[model samples]
Target: MTAVPEERVDRFATARQIADAVLLEGYVLYPYRASAAKNRLRWQFGVLVPPGYGRDAAEHSHQRTECLMEPRRGDRLAVELRFLHARRRTVQRAVGSRAFETVEELALADRVLVPWDEGVEERIELTFPVDELAAGEVVRAVRLAAGEEQETVQEDGRPVGRLLRRHEQVDAVLRLSVQEVPGPYGTLRLTAVVENTSDWRPPAGAGRDAALARSLVSAHLLLGLERGRFLSATDPPEWAREAAAECRNEHTWPVLAGGDGRADVLLSSPIILEDHPQVAPESPGELYDATEIDEILALRTAALTDREKREARGTDPRAGAVIDLADSMPPEVLERLHGAVRALRDVTGAPADPADGQPWWDPGGDPGVDPDRDRVQVGEHSVGAGSRVLLKPGRRRTDAQDLFLHGRTALVEAVLHDVDGSVHLAVTIEGDPGADLWRAQGRFRYFQPDEVEPLEEP
Candidate 1:
């Protein structure tokens, strides 16, 4: 039996990776986001050229430089390199370490702190494409000077959560400009801007502003930072939830039913409240009070059950309450209807009389009242129950008077035809200019007295 001796072996490659083979031209630069305009740490980068590089590559070179973005914890950092000619812009070749590894792998690789030299003034000017500069988004360029080591190398070989440490401040003056841009949805546009002349400082928490500013210049800068994350758009994401609850409480009774030409508007793509018909009372007054409108729009969107919305064929009684059909009714009318129903309920505190013979206050009245009770009294109003009150057409509502006299439009706006051929309807109308001259409409229906049923609360 022979005893084997224990030995440790480590693998190493003498050949340089293709990415490392590419020479660092001169300097690197990083731009700060436009939102952080007041900060002094806009542009920061370093310059490192290959040992034997000359001026030839700068003037007559086939090389183009590009900035690469990789995701990190909460933000993304700028990376630089030579661009390779490709069929498409996205297919352009990666520069530096990116050439040898996938973006994910490169981001996860061990981080090396960029070294800096303070004695030499490392400054480089960069020009951005005119189209890329806008108001909402700003870009700044940092000048990286060529020099000696700025910071010590990481003692631990492995990459950690916080990779780079700041060493020194590298400030550069910047000139910035911005332009407005149309956004993805509509006439709404965002701004994009480009800035130069920055007083470069290190990122927050970095030990040395100058050293960190210089260290920020490597080809693989921002390697430890996060990718493009949209934080502004989703501020306090839970606010959406709170908004939903408030809408439900406000719109509980006589929920808005759709109107004619309203189906397409309600079901339209993007569902912008501004483009739709003015449906709420607050609308046609203030442009910004779209909260209720948005909530109603959402309810209608969720209520879309039928693939083909039932359009106005003849005169369907339930059509007035239909979600899709309610679009045509002006928001003011709907708001009034809601208010009327709520007011009636509060005033009466009891049910109105039914059209058919039955006790109006009795929930257990005649059988004509619908058991399902999708229809309920907001106050003391009832459609099936006939009202003793006579609603005459108003003086200002010549149209209503004409309709009533001519029998053109029904006095009652909404109706229901029961299985036994009984009719009941609810009504609303544009009021007169004054209270005395106000035009009014009410819900009406004809039902067999023998077949009348008690209406229950929905």
Candidate 2:
């Protein structure tokens, strides 16, 4: 029987860095604005909160996260826990009355009142820390909490109204454990779990509680390894070296382990991260040529609408420099800008064939008399609709779905192309049937062209 390999980490950042990236995932985007539709869902990943709760009530919500890690024996592992705390602020706005007299009613006039502008204030009040966990020990739970901030309204230096505290106390809990696995280099498995243990709930019948509840229970975990070396991809054992080489990249590689026989496996990343930089260009001309192409591509892909282009020039400070350069250009040169934009848009927007590196319209005339003979050639056989194909293993996959579908034969129902012009085979596997995955109104199983091979007919 073929041995199943363990999952491994390829690329990783420090726990703190990972936490920061996770926290920022749904927080905001470029041109950050509260009104941006993209910002509607603030936190989307790893959320654990009650069904109906608000940010204010989240302080009382409990959330937990579990992470698995592998450490070498005798090595001390340090785990750092971190999270963000939001603080509320109070501000006072001046209220005043205005009076105006109409021409017809100039003899008498009453007072007209204008609404005061709303004021906002924000700050980070306090920082809470969770207890650190050591190697081989289990962290049952660690709690975190923040106090509420008081708010008040004042008129002419005298308190006119005392508003209740707007900020609610926040709390959370974290748990950790380590499991040992026997291997060539005495391996230890680590698991870290974080939980929101607050018992707070939002007020019943609150209209926006549902949306708030979704964001309240979410948390991000940033994991980092501080000790030990990860297995090497290029230098893996003889039995597993081939698999490792196929999967090797700058960030990760498949590890090899020797068992009853030999098997290609996966190992987690080491604590220390390494960098691989591109080699320097051999000639100045070559460098300049590449740079020129990159600049052309960048301008073409910017693809901003006229209104957006104008808005960027008006609002973005960086655009000022470019605008100044364009303004100083000769009239004849400036007149060509519009044409250049259109030309670039046309060229970049056209889809090109991946196989021949030519546009779809330029499919160099038919080479054979049979027009239907262009079906994909897989292995030693050609496959088309109604043809049978077997799923390939260990190619372009990091999930269990690959293992589940590996070696399974499927019937190709159709050949489809995505909006980007990539091709896919629409297939239904034997013994396993399900609804097709939909994206942009089209159905697909995300099987890449290379993940399948045609099965020859008997």
Best by TM-score: 2
Q: Cα deviation in Å at residue 45, candidate 2? A: 2.0
Q: Which residue runs does candidate 1 get wrong by more than 4 Å?
A: 1-270, 273-386, 392-458
Give the alpha carbon lDDT tens digit for every residue of 386-456 in model 1.
Answer: 22223333344335333352222222333454535444433322242332232233223222222222233
The Cα local distance difference test for each model comes to 0.25, 0.38
Per-residue lDDT of 386-430 in model 2, one digit per residue for the tens? 777887755555368767888888867666554465666766776
True-structure lDDT of candidate 1: 0.25
Model 2 ranges with Cα > 4 A deviation: 1-19, 50-74, 86-92, 96-137, 140-142, 146-166, 207-218, 223-226, 230-458
Q: Please report, as a residue range, the 10-residue window in candidate 1 with the lowest summed lDDT.
A: 7-16
TM-score of each: 0.15, 0.39
